[model samples]
Target: MASTTTVPALKADRPLLGIAFMLAAGLLFTLLDTAVKWLTQSYSPVQVVWARYAGHMLVLGGYLLILGWPRCREIMASVESLPGQFVRGLLLLAASTFAFLAFRELPLLQVYVINFSSPLLVTLLAIPLLSERVTAARGIAVAVGFVGVVIAVGPVDWRAQPAALLPFGMALCFALYQLATRRFGRNDHPLASLFYAGLAGALVSSLVVPFFWSPVALGDTPLFLLVGTLGAISQLGLIMAMRCAPASLVSPFLYLQIVWATVSGYLVFGDVPLLETYLGAVLIIGAGIFLATRKR
Candidate 1:
């Protein structure tokens, strides 16, 4: 009885740990967004992404250094789903590419608001991918959240800003990335998962970045480094987050990034989100809060 009770108690803490990981990921995500937005302004999105993955590789190197190559190789060999990790890494790379492209044209707050739709998209993808049950409340909340997205884009004249639609694509990629992470990340070593997250991306970018590369100004070199470090650490945090908690429970915590995005947008870019964005964000946030606070 004691062992059974202890085991269940320990198991219950995983979701909380996942939420904590999401919270940290959310903050780092905001910083990443700000950094990427800045870098993409001066560099090709592809080149900026190359710097990001380059940094990710450096950070991943440090992680492997701590573990030693033998253990790292062993973890790689022992992975139950190396292909899954590879797929997820590609998905994340695609998501980052979409985000960088969108951010070059959109404000941090607006881009993030559109990006917030990933939670809803995750909720939907969870059904088909993870086979999680969605209650009516969740379904309705998802619908309303999307309504907010439409509202945020402006009920009319949305076509005037075609760039606004880019984040919708970004959101879809990110949602799929999140779902893949949750689906396959659990039994793999965090290091292995982290390594593959940037492995394919770095390789692809290394080959292609030269065609699009521009010289980084001396003062702006740090931003290149920042995106890579933030990318690696945040990717690790997200891997741990999904491993710790269900996609449904943790995905909503991502909305917290909106607050950080808003602040960072104003502070870094002196940009304010349009009124429609606030209205749309409220609805999206409300739906998320409902899902997050509901009974288990």
Candidate 2:
């Protein structure tokens, strides 16, 4: 009886660990974005993105090596799902590239606010792409979430600044990337997707990075490397988090990233979002949370 009781307690602990991982991942991702923004000031966003992917690959490769040759071979031998993995990687690359380009022009807080809409997009896309059934409440939640996005965009005419739409585009790409992940999850180990995500971006970027690469200042090389290292760590954190807890329970924790982004943007970039952005964020976040918790 005591052992059974202890088992339930141990099972309950998993979600807590998952939430902790999600929080850590959020902060790490925010730091990666901060570094990317800093890098973009001196290098092209393309070059910065390449560094992000290359660095991710380097770190992931080191881990696979440490896991021993058999583990490495197992990861490499998984070929049936490569196409899906490759596409997911491409979508993430596109998403990150779009956001980075917008980062060069927009405030970090605004970029985050727009990007966080991915949860809503995911909720909506699941209905059509995955054939998941969505009840009326989720439909309303989705609509309200977009209204939040509009508010986050502020009162200015959106057409006046085409660049403002970039983060939304990023959100769309990311949502699709996630959908692909869900599709691939049925047949592949999560590690396989991670390997392919890093591999896809690293290989494709290698071709173009040369054309865009500028010599880094000697002092900044560490920071450049740091960007990729943090990205890899954050991605690992996300995987661990999912393994630790239910996806529905842990996912809502991701919105915590906007809090980090807002604080970091203010301190690092001196960005102060207008009231509209804040209100929109609240709505989007509220709707997202509701969707995350509502019966799936």
Candidate 3:
């Protein structure tokens, strides 16, 4: 979403620092995805999603406690749109669910290349969902972005690897989530929104996870904790980046995750992306950056 917290902004001259944070955030998220993919091989995707949100809640809960009860209450009071938060949060959970499912069946490079189309989805969705006007440039970019998606999904057997489409579903969910944030986050503090998101994910995942629960080996417990911690830190990095620079300057760096995912996928999983994936990723990245830099 590239949303900044309503906190102190960095000096205008320091956009580089924000760019750095964006790069780091990209790497963290890639690492998080890699971790989730590994965990899903052994546990049900639902169970992995539960551990993710549950751990995030525990981490966020502890941070709130450290902030003191009164400050916590003040943060809670900052929410002007509770239902919007819930809707956005659940949408994210759905995206996360799709992420695990997609990763289980697709290569990391493939999943991320498709995921990059999310900004284009957001642009198309904004017209009806947020009632924002989309310029022709954006509309064309959206079209090109989908073209990139088609290229990325080239020649896949639907019957054999239907999960390949999961990333597209994830992108749609994320597009809706971003719209919800834009619509509802005007009056809500970024931290406040983050809290509500974690809360909603934690509460819901807790209730449903039991039915899909799998026993955790003591050694694998660290992986579960890592998923939660990485999610929190990755989000914090985004907050920091947006605080330090304009979205136009930093949002482009988010694509660097594609590079990181490629390298990580090769080194960690010995998976190499196809030539078509590279071609499609360039189109998707170009389209996303064009949309990001536009004044609209």
Instruction: Provide the TM-score for each candidate, comma-separated.
Output: 0.92, 0.87, 0.86
Clashes of 2: 0
Count of clashing residue pairs in every prediction: 0, 0, 0
Query: What lDDT does the true structure give each of the candidates?
Result: 0.83, 0.76, 0.76
Candidate 1 lDDT for residue 124: 79
Among all windows of 10 consecutive residues in model 3, the one with the lowest summed lDDT is 1-10
lDDT: worst 10-residue window of model 2:
1-10
What is the lDDT, from 0 to 100, of the residue 252 in candidate 1?
86
Question: Looking at candidate 3, what is the lDDT of residue 84?
Answer: 74
Candidate 3 TM-score, C-alpha based: 0.86
Give lDDT tens digits, candidate 2, residues 182-285.
Answer: 55433455566678888888888889988988999998899889988997888767666655654444555677777898989999999988888888888877
Candidate 3 structure lDDT: 0.76
Candidate 1: stretches off by over 4 Å? 1-13, 155-160
Kindly list the per-residue Cα lDDT of model 3 for residues 203-289, writing each as its tens digit.
888889889898999999999999998877776676566556544445556766778998989998999788888888788778767
Name the best candidate (by TM-score): 1
Residue pairs clashing, model 2? none
